[model samples]
Target: MSKQLDESEIQRLAAYDIAHVVHPQFHRADHDGAVIYESGSGAVLRDVRGNEYIDGLSSLWNVAVGHGRRELADAAAEQMAQLAFSNGYTGYANLPSIRLTERLLGIVYPNMSGVFYANSGSEANDFAIKAARYFWYTSGQPAKTKIISRGEAYHGSTMAATAITGMAPFHKGFGPEPPDFIQVPTCYPYRCQWCAAKPGCTLECADAIERAIVEAGADTVAAVIAEPVHGAGGVIPPDPGYWPRLRQICDRHDVLLIADEVITGFGRTGRWFALEHWDVQPDILTIAKAVTSAYVPLSAFIASERVHRAILEAPADAKFMIGCTNSAHPTACAVALRNLQILEDEGLVERARVMGDRLNAGLARLRESPHVGDVRGLGLMAAVEVVQDVATRAPFPPSAGIGPKLARAMRDRGVVTRVKGESILFAPPLVVTEEQADRMVDVTGDAIDAVTKGQA
Candidate 1:
């Protein structure tokens, strides 16, 4: 049961938040006046006003096992009572973290042998970038330091991670990015740049990475980074041939491949890891978000045996040092361990596949909608791209704020979702039931109709 707050208490908290809390990636004015979401269970959240909403985006793409799992809470409690915190610095290790690492290795790709802990997906990627560069520098290839990412990629928000991030809006207000963080075209079949010159997608987007490496001199490129499915970049999954081609290109150039599995790992995409969809093996796989199901902030940087061996063989003085205070936090690891157990024990990964098929089929049926330009996604992570002219694929003006309007309509209809530019994306909890999915789809379609009636 959730604690019910009086109206005055809710108002007081809202006032305090407006005065002190600086929300990330949110409109301050709107957030200041927003409803206070107090608690959640299953796939539903309840605001202070007691209005219930479907956890449509899975609380920012986390919460895979859904809300309010007592087992996870108990796991955290036990770890906290035994040993709350431990420094994971050199020469220091905790039993929970060690066990967590062993368990993770048992589940990750066959070649991945080691894991580095961090507090969030951003830190994991930051560590990965440093590790990749350090691996080359110590191997006597100091010039191989550049990392090739793709446009529209969402790596992280840290300075180094932001530089590698392909979104322009995230870079705004920040000064010039660091050098050697280059970006190539992404595998977006709906809007492929190569399709203009060629009739169809030649997987030229995948070829672009090789072109970027060669153009920059492959000796100067350390690795190529990408998400198996571009999550925040509007849930854009790559072409079927993209990942294999990327592996081949990286092999040809001797550049490492980094899969930012922050959003797609841990069964969000039906598979334990999205790379399994294409049998592509990345040298380093960065994972977070659902690792602990957001019960606690935790992320893991899983490195392949090949990369681990090189790092291990480096000169003793050449240490690849990068970490956070909460890195390998014992409680976080314990929570994550239990979370993974729940995910596997309950067969949630397979659930994601079944529910995802249902969700996509529902969204695909909405193609009859005048404003729906594209419907694309894999597993439970999906999106419905809104447009002003579907025939021309002309996007609605950002000034119109159609996405937000549609989201508001859904909210009023008892659903929560994310609005990214012209796309309304969905990544509901893996435990979401068929009835809940039906409600989500029904509300979404009605919301689109109600909001875009005249415009469409």
Candidate 2:
């Protein structure tokens, strides 16, 4: 273990961070209040001040196998010693990249035949967009350039990924919205305007995709991109029938289905991939995060055979020309390969299913609380929706500051998670034990009670 820093040294580091580092989702007002994490092991993290908290969000929906594994560190070091970087352009290749791709193809949808590497989820999704457009362009349907996304979807921060993202906050101050990106309703059963009142899912949200495609003129729509289980968007899993119908809709309209599995891939969900739960295969799939359990920066977009053939057949002048400098960094790929091995050997995926049941069951007890409007999740990923009035499902206004207050309460109670709007998101590592899972639930329930007590 590294030497533990004194309080003064920790404060000095925090001062340096405030001076130099610009974090993502940055809030100027809250910058100084940031928790400076120093070390982690399994589902627990310790701040610079030596306070430990249960990692309820898996350090941002990644780190499936957990943190501080010697094997992963050794993997990176071994690969770096031999070959740290390589040119992954069309003509050049690396062994780790080649082996990792082969392993991915064997595990992912059988129809997928090619993988394009990038450095992050945003870049992977951007490549997904390019691959979708390239397929249509080469197939003589150049007009089919529009991509449809769902509301509450969080793709990434890149320009194209931002345009494809459905959340307005991400788009705000991002300059002009890129053209040809269409937004449609998501399968959010909780606050769904169409079918929330119904006894069962009408799947009106899925049909909304069809409506958008029709409105855009199906011929002009290239692809419909979505997360199989919406992650950053409140951990909302679609209805069981959602993906099958979505597959049919995309097939009927000749629109490609791009599953952004950045957060749900690599055993974060019970299955290796979330769409696999529904037996639905997407035309293009983007995966990252737990591909290496966030030990290193690496991501890739896989293309189905049909899409691959289209790109392969492109004319010399109109070649599918897109590549990243660190496309398949040898060190990252090596680390990812070892990470995959760790996941399979330990059966972390099945653990997620079993532990997910335990976690959800614990959270279900909180439903009796008047403020908890809903409790929902799949596998180890879940959310608790807080509301002002359970009868009307009315949300607390922004001025109430319920999310921030609940977040602070949970942190104080030795749990750390994401509190978005009125929803508290939880995605602990797949390796989280039953005791840790129960502690998270208990802390969440107690935090809710403490934060919302006496609130009208």
Candidate 3:
């Protein structure tokens, strides 16, 4: 069942578009014609003009439960009618938020005890860093304000969050970023800088963290923040033994390890969290996206019992304080809780494991494709890099913008994807059946071939 938006509604949606109210992640001057997506159901979205497209990127790496699930809508409506907005500030408690905390922590890969709610992933990670710093500060580690992150990683966009991001593009204009943040090499095995002959390669990428901690003076480093499996920095999966070694390094240095699971949490990986893949536990965790399957804006940061005890030690006046007006909107929390239920009830986690294997198999067949320099991913998340030369692994000339062109071609063939740098990213909803996933790969491969002219 779909609700088709007529022409009049489309015009109405476009009328008040001064760009701020409509365009996002794009320059206002470049605001193109708005495609009003009217409604969606399992795996498909219908636009204002009635064109349908399969959600290839899961609506920005969320939407794990797909679209138009009646149960989600009903759950949101029920909670809204009962109680919609109440402050999460100063001992105020709400039903959906409370219930969701139980449900979320129930699945916490590391048995996190306390949770803090926020409206988006950026805010969650930003606040997580704050809490980490504050935890050490209150414990007499005043010098422990610096946070260490990885190169090419994206934690958030807020100042503290941006400071933690590993990508250079985000920091081009924002110089003199917070001094506490430092970056080591990201575990991008495909384009690994540490991948070379036996002379100097010993998976030193993980060893780089120990070097970073030592260089920063372990006494001053508060935490090490990283995505379990890097996203937005090019869906890079860690090499074997990477996470466990990182954990051991963090333990040796006494720095808290924060897993920014905003993108890989909630079954984006075959497991609930990518860290689970290595049986590693983190001191702090942050997640958004598929938490509510994009039905609502919700994000959370969870702290281990050890970190929670830091907050408990504070006096009443010294209680750690951080919140927003929409911190745990009941409707959103209700939807998130139900989203988890749908995942569990449907056994989609196991399904993701099986279908993810199928996705890789399809990509495995395309390894010889001229345009595909590398096909890499785990579970439902993966990427195919477009390169101009296989030997040097040089990306296509940025002037050609081949990635965007290929994406447009894929959309024309009824798939929507995104490009991070020169990498073509594919992260479909976990609900995507094997056939739908194959279409995802097929459409992407077809689009690449069409646009690149068999040129690698």
| Ranked by TM-score, top first | 2, 1, 3
**lDDT: which is higher, 1 or 3?**
1
RMSD of each: 1.7, 1.5, 2.5
lDDT, candidate 3, equals 0.84
Tell me the tens digit of each residue's lDDT in model 2 across 1-456. Answer: 226777778778888888789999887777877898889999999887778999999998888999899999999999999986877788889999999999999899989999988999999999999999989999999999999999999999999999988888998898887899999989999999998998989998999999999999999999999999999988999999999999999999999999999999987779999998999999999998999999999999999999999888878999788987999899999999999999999999999999999999999899999899999999999999999999999999889899988988899999999887989999999999889999999999899998898431
Report the C-alpha displacement of residue 287, candidate 1, in angstroms: 0.5
> lDDT by residue for model 3 over 151-248, one digit each (tens)?
98988788888888887788887788877678888777767777743333366888989999999999999999999888888888887688899999
For model 1, what is the error of residue 292's alpha carbon versus the real structure, in angstroms, after optimal superposition? 0.4
How do the residues 35-154 of candidate 1 rate in per-residue lDDT, one tens digit apiece? 678889999989888889999999889999999899999999999999979788888999989999988998889999879999888889989988898878888899999999989899
Which model, 2 or 3, shows the larger TM-score? 2
Q: After superposing candidate 2 on the true structure, give the runs of residues whose Cα lies further than 4 Å from its correct spot.
A: 1-4, 454-456
Q: Over the full model, what C-alpha lDDT does candidate 2 score relative to the true structure?
A: 0.92
Each prediction's total of clashing residue pairs, residues at least 3 apart in sequence or on different chains, is 0, 0, 2
Which candidate, 1 or 2, has the higher TM-score?
A: 2
